[model samples]
Target: MKKIFIGMAILSAGLFTSCSDFLTEEPKQEQSNELTFATFDGVNKAAAAMYGMFQSDAWYDGEFTLMSELRCGNAKNPTSVPGSGRYRSDTQWIYSDRSTSPLWSYAYYTIARANNVINNLDDKVGVDATQQQVNNVKAEALFIRALCYFDLVITYCQPYNYNATEDDKMGVPLVLVTENGKPARDSKENVYNQIVADLLQAESIMADDYVRAGVTDKAATPTKPAIQALLSRVYLYMNKWQEAADYATKVINNKKYELAPADAYAAMFSAATAPEGGEIIFEVYGSDKNEYWDNSGWAHLPYITTTDDKGSHGDVCATKDLYDLYSEGDIRKSMYKQHGNDYFPTKYSGKPKDSDPKYTNVPILRLSEMYLNRAEAIINGASIQGVTAESDLRKIATVRGASQTAAATKQGVFDERRRELAFEGHIAADYARCNKSMTRKDFDDSKNKDVAFPSYMWALPIPNRECTANPNVAQNPGY
Candidate 1:
């Protein structure tokens, strides 16, 4: 998955100066995809390039994800000393800066790449054995596009429940074509509709027998399971409880993955390779050797890198709130490392003394989430036999070496999710959709963290650059 620009050819032309009969090669730049998607092998490489976009600093590796964790309140800037300016705005909850929302441009950039591959697939005349190639490639690209748009909208727009009359709220621009267009902000419903449509269309076209290639260590590439898994997440955000549960079940029931047992849990965190355990439903690979942009491991990295091992460590510390949630001897609590008084997550770092590249894979979705999603849905209203909120609670508790909670309640589910998915990027979002505020206004004792709505403080503002350049763009209220 790390092979940069694996096989998407760069088309160029040169004249033969010593020609017996003058010959000039036709330009290929105009028909780049003609050769790029000429066969299954070519299209496969193009798909890899599409997936590679996640490695950029804007998406998984850096700001796009880092900002999400900052607001979770589980991890805060060091207490005694103010840290690096890298994500200063984020930790302080001042999303007024343009850089805080890097996903805005990078996501659209990736979408354009996906469109290039997807738009070209339809006109492949009568090529040999290219139908399956086209189908597989198109499905993957559509999944890529949907994945980006989902991340973008969630960052830029208010939560689905932000406005009772949801039709009036604006979402990030829904760009679908390769050619640039002066697009205006669309309604939230329309943006979500496009996301759902892309994912469903992707699911329908994917080969039933399709097994994602290019990685054996983890689920690096998108497949039917990944697509279904994300649909579950998108539905959850949309507040479609039943649909979320159903789609989650589709991924959970598939025999391809399983949860990493309690005994192997420690190894799962500091895994030298992309993990092979059942828990990793989907992930993005990073380098222990090269610090590529969007390396996927750095989202949890500390602000400073002055440790014994060159690990990105100790800049951000887990909050007392998150630590208190773990009673005792819970495997999930041990995921964080303590430094004097501050505690930081070790899931993305190496052991304190041991030296390694510190590059870790980012788990985009996991089996545990399926159970949680279903449990929440059932607890809310939708009922599914053979599983209850309590059952799901016990399932995760057993794996984490924690006492099994017999009764399920709204708060119980929220607490369990915080314990299970902390620092993995859901902390803030879970609170937002539930209309909950940060556990403490200022974890670092700074008086600036405010979680009030009309402020759009929780929801990021449209980047200043975009608002300036695009006339049709409308900034969020507070900004």
Candidate 2:
């Protein structure tokens, strides 16, 4: 867990390269950290760079999202042998020390960048920035760090409630500061506690209405509601049912967001920008104008999920197991389009005019998810006055033109979640946290069609490079 420093040359090329409308200015490259953090302008540029890191292909921009769906029954490779040779390993649940996800390295890289911002904020806060302005930046940094850690823990460690002794299980290293040291893995309990601490402290200092300046897609930046939404999800993972329901209720009660109507459901994701007053609470902003656009070009999710028509890759396809869950009248059922014999999800189908599949924003959180989270929480012994689990579940079902007959039951809620959140990337994590084995009935590969619960494969291996470099960091049990 030693800090991975971004070389000045690499930082100049990647960090300063602005995503259109998200960042307004690019600061001159300075050779030293002092010059970079010396002024409020410099600090602001650094914060923008931290935000830009989310667009990396290893993280939200593509693989992480696609892998989540592919590993679960929600998605599959269209052919037993991948035609494009993309997502084959993931769809087949193949993992080795050398073939693990790059997310471990990329997530830690982003965390190190966030640590730089958090560590320097107090000393650098001067006449250039007000106290409140500095606090907002710090809050944003904390939120980003928490998010990265949460992803790392879920991917590299077993679920919080995996067993009676799960709390003592090894989690990823907790690197809260920018320093040179090989840190060992922290316990699962300690890692989750750190995530909660970071999020709660961020919530205390950030303004409810504060949006980062110069960001065209406001949901890309962390807001009060965004923090709450994440907390709801995190609590649900931790099995803190009451807390999960309460936090979800906070976001659901907010007037800033509303569920997109059934007619506009598909359009909401395919739009260039998030629709105003739409369901998206947080998303990774994608744009053709983004200069650091390496991930969005050909290897983007839109290309992977689309048909070969219009030069797209068409590698990932929706499983019949998932497709059959949607009833005939449900608007969500229309989110898929058939090609040959395979069904591809249209959630990441790029903007209408785009010749290539790029510039499609990726939704990380939405209002519909809040409804799902609360419903799951309520079904597991949490209570809300005048709001049964059925009522919360119906909120989503009604808007999407689906039947609510399956509401109020745990399995029903889980099935509804798969239908509502498919391809947006919650499937694998949902199954793992709930201690349910994945059953991919439509997959062509017989050997991996069923992944048993509590298997070591659920926790992906640490990247080989990290294990080689950091002696103190341990790989997960399977690898």
- Count of clashing residue pairs in every prediction: 2, 0
Question: Which digits, one per residue and each the tens of the lDDT, describe model 1 over residues 1-479?
Answer: 00112122222111101111111221122335456656555444454545444544456655565667677666666654444445554666766746557777767766766776676677663565367667777888898888888887777777777775443388877767654455778888888888899899988888865755544343666778888988998998888989988998888788877777778786765564445547777676544322233333444343232122454545566777778788687887777666656666767664333544344556678888988888888788767767778887788888778865625877788888888887677866788777776546337545556565434666677878777777778877666
Every candidate's CA RMSD? 7.3, 2.4
Alpha carbon lDDT at 407, candidate 1: 54
Question: Which residue pairs of candidate 1 clash?
Answer: 61-294, 258-278
Q: Rate the local accuracy (lDDT) of all candidates.
A: 0.66, 0.80
What 10-residue stretch in candidate 1 is worst by lDDT?
A: 13-22
The segments of candidate 1 whose C-alpha lies over 4 angstroms from its true place after superposition are: 1-34, 37-40, 80-85, 97-99, 164-168, 216-218, 272-274, 288-308, 311-313, 350-357, 404-407
Taking the tens digit of each residue's C-alpha lDDT, what string does model 2 give over 1-479?
Answer: 33543223333334455545575544554445667777766766777767665676677768888899888888888853255778877867888889877788778777877787787788656668887888898889889989999999888888888754443388888887756667888898888988898899899999888998887778888998999999999999999999999999999999999999999998988787778888898988876665545733777777778875577778889998789898878999888888767888888887767456466788999999998899999899998888888887777878898864455887988899899889877888898899998777777764588899979888888888788877887777766
